[model samples]
Target: MDAAMFSIGNSSSASDNETVVIASNEDLYSYAERVVAAVICSIICIFGSIGNSLVIIAVLLSRKLHTPPNVFVVSLATADLLTSLFLIWDVVALLSSDGWPLPNAKWLCTMTSFVIFVCIGTSLSNLAAISLNRYILITKPYRTYQRIYSPVNIGLMVIFTWICPNLLSLLLSLTKIVGFGYNRKYFICCHFGQQPEDELLFILSDVLLIFIVLVVVVLSYIFVLKHVRQHFKGKRRREVQGIVMQASTSGNDTERQDRQRSTTAENSISQPDPSGQPIRRRENYKDLQVTKNLLLVVVVFFVCFLPYSFLIIFPRSDSFHLYAILLALMNSCVNPVIYARRHPHFKIVLSAMIKCQYQNIPEPTGIAKRFFSRGINPIL
Candidate 1:
């Protein structure tokens, strides 16, 4: 998309660009390169589709996964699923041996591009939402977290993540501001607006969107880091002060008192604290672990997505642009590895699905229960 946008928005002569584009398509990706590209896209699409489906299905079926954050995970999976489905068509268009397999179905290709763009945009939005959720959960009061991440609010956020992309893409297309269509430059469907000024504005807007997402994600993690560091620092300081006071008081004690003190210390270490501090510490530990896991998701997301966004600003060779597109598409595939393979309940349930271990599994309620209610249902 960025490649097409750059090629289309360039001030060069259209005819010259077309000649160069057509020549470059044949020259750039040879038969071997094309096959490799196809294999990569196929893997991304197949695994991405299946993995994300498992995530959604796991959440739907497993009562344990019905958390506020998993709502974001499902939303993310939904976006990736649409992306994985569209990518097969995307690669087919770009890698076709014949010029455009469907000569008469240009609109179909355009629609596919639109869906791809929207789904990708939605993925970014969902990531941003997840970052915000993490920030609130880590830094805010328990009641405040509960209030903000309540089911009604989560539903609204899921709605926002999906709706925001659709609206933005529609605005671009309806206004003819960010033209997304066939780019002969790389034999890929991408952007090039009719009006240069409008295209420039669209580019600026896209940059701003990228900037916003970056800011939200970066700042959220930064704040979480600060909070965690300060919390542990204060805790260590208090422990040090307590030790100092204890030593000062014990300095006047006899050898028998010292022996008794050592015994008391061992006993205290062995016994669990009756105070709520241990429980609070445990909660903090759990939150920190969760934050780290989601941080992995965010890191993978940016690694997959940033190159494409960078290429948009600094337009590169056809090969680089294609590489960027592939990397961006891969963002969809990598999330499920984080969610399904790494997430606790998600791993268990998805592993069960893989092993066909439904017999011992407690009957899940809602969708899975209904779907599996009648043996060999017609929907199967």
Candidate 2:
């Protein structure tokens, strides 16, 4: 192997008769850390697999959650689950041994790396689509249901997200564009000796994917807040107008009644108020506060996935190790917490799922029906 081509590890070359192996980075703390990572990864894989499975089940079973956003979430959960599955092996293998045990099957490492890349990329892009969908829903809510959330658009988004990254990864893998060239008896593992072009492609894709997702998330939330503000303002104006109309109608009736019974007008005027406008306003205020809490949930989702993007773009950077660990573990750690915090409905559904006591399943519609039925219109 040319030292200049791949500078990651300092493994001295071996003669043709000798077997090549990279020297292991072993230390007491490293060993302990590896064990910790493995444990964490295992926990994440277990919970993530269960939680995402439950999510998919709940969506399938519940008619009420048959919305575009929920569909997107289902896709997201699948991506996360797949990522956790692919990543957990590396964690376990690392803790058990310093190198991949199956060096004979070099393509396994390559395929594993490719799968990881695809999952993470698809997950990030799906998230971006979700954010954009939310933004459209809030900003142009009236037309949202008909246009943006339509089966065709959602299908296209899914296909776009899934195909692009895999294609890129496939090209890189086929040409050995990212890893060391064919002559180099380089070890094929999660961490590979990458070329500059390979590094640039990987980093660029990671950065662009993350940047766009974050931008969508941030801008979507901002617009959602603004939309919520406007919504409340319009509602408040309506309430005020309603109050004025009620007061006017009541005053007109009172005047007419006074004309008929002048002697008892003072007594009628002393009657207490019947309508509870104050109570209604308080309830509306409470709902507004609840919406704010929901916004916090959305924020949590973005924050939890943020580190994974950093890891992808700066794979060689110092932060990669810690962030990759977090990314692997976060799929199971974040969603239930976010849902419990933001949406009471999700909790109820989740609880039902846990109890194995589900309600009557809703008839699947749109993309979901298409998904489960496997019938695709040729035009699409």
lDDT string for model 2 (312-373, tens) is 55534432445454554465446655554455456666665565444323443354455445
> RMSD per prediction, one decimal?
5.5, 9.6
Q: Give candidate 2 regions above 4 Å deviation.
A: 1-24, 27-29, 174-177, 180-193, 196-198, 244-250, 254-298, 305-324, 359-380
Error of 1 at 264 (Å): 13
lDDT of 1: 0.71
Among all windows of 10 consecutive residues in model 2, the one with the lowest summed lDDT is 273-282
The lDDT of model 2 is: 0.55
Q: What C-alpha lDDT do the candidate models reach, one value each?
A: 0.71, 0.55
Error of 2 at 68 (Å): 1.2
Top of the candidates by lDDT:
1
> In candidate 1, what are the lDDT values of residues 225-333, reduced to their tens digit?
8766655655555556556656777756587557756765554333233222121332445567777888899889888877777776654444787778888888888
List clashing residue pairs in candidate 2.
Answer: none
